[model samples]
Target: MLKRIATALWGKFESTAELKKFGFLAAIFGFIIGTYWTLRPMKDSIFNAIVGMDYLPWAKMLSLVVIFPLVIAYSKLIDKYPRHKVFYILISIYACASLLFCVAFLNATLGLVNTVQSPWRLIGWAWYVFVESFGSLIVALFWAFTTDTTKPDSAKRGFPIIVLFGQVGNILGPLLLNARRLGFANSAPVVAICAGLMVFSGLLFCKIT
Candidate 1:
């Protein structure tokens, strides 16, 4: 029976409420992973378009420098605030920053329209670091929140479900935002969509937690 198969696969739940909690948690994980995957290719393409691929190593080096401060700030926030509050704070910051970048991409001077590849093009470097730091911080924070909240027995069942959804998002996110469909001319549309997903994920986190 389908019930037997699902029980075997996902383990038995004590209550319907518990099952629903895991389902929502799984969705939150999926959204975060999906947004990260979607942004990865966009980061490279936009950076290449605006700054040239030759400078990629420099941009990555910049990301390393930027991430340390970000992680430190994140740790301070975690220490100062409740975990859910920290999640909201960080998610709001990222969602707003993403939207700002989406709008920035529309500007002729700051965006892909500025085809000149100079080291002085700071937007490209900033964007590369933004996405890179986002990947590291957001994913780590989510897992930290998950482990803090989940009981060990529930996590055995729930973590697998969450990972499964995250993997699904990982596969689908980039596939949906492929270059052929969105084209390389403007990244605004893709960035806008990613921002929306980030916002939705934050909302989901609020609801679930």
Candidate 2:
């Protein structure tokens, strides 16, 4: 029966409290991952649209150069603040940045329609790095925090649930953001939605704590 399948997958929870904790963790992971997946395609598409695909390789190289310092700064941040505080701070910062990008994308001169020029092209590169770092940092931060807080025994049961929900997010994120439904090729709306999701993911983590 379905009960057997559920037990086989998630294992039996010791109590309702344990089950609820696992559910919240799963939801938080799902939303974070979903937002990342949604942003992933836009990183490349928006970059190519605004900066020209010719510069794509250089933009990628820029990310490699940028990521080392970023990781070091992230480590210092973790040392200075509690993990939850780091999570809230990073999520808030990304949310605000996303909104800023959304507004920039709305501007004809600075947005996706502008011809690829040196200074204007900088925004495209920045956008690329922004989403790239977000994927690298936020996902890693979630797992680091999760494993830090979750007990090994409970993790055996709960991790599967979290992974399953994350996969669902991975699938649905792109599906729901399909351009045909959204009815435009502009990235501003998608960026705005991502900001909202990031805020929601932070709030969900608040509930988890």
Most lDDT-accurate candidate: 2
- Per-structure clash totals for the candidates: 0, 0
Name the lDDT value of residue 113 in candidate 2.
64
lDDT (10s digit) by residue, model 2, range 120-155:
567889999999999999988889899999899989
**Please, what are the lDDT tens digits per residue for candidate 1 over residues 1-209?**
64455468988876666777777788988988998999998888889988889999989888998899999999999999988888888888888888889888889898777788877888888899989988999899999989998899988977998999999999989888765676755667788888888889888887777
Q: Pick the candidate with the highest TM-score.
A: 1
Number of residue pairs clashing in candidate 2, backbone atoms closer than 3 angstroms, sequence gap of 3 or more or interchain = 0
List CA RMSD, all candidates.
Answer: 1.9, 2.1
The list of candidate 1 runs beyond 4 A from truth reads 1-6, 182-185
Model 2 alpha-carbon drift over 4 Å, by segment: 1-8, 115-120
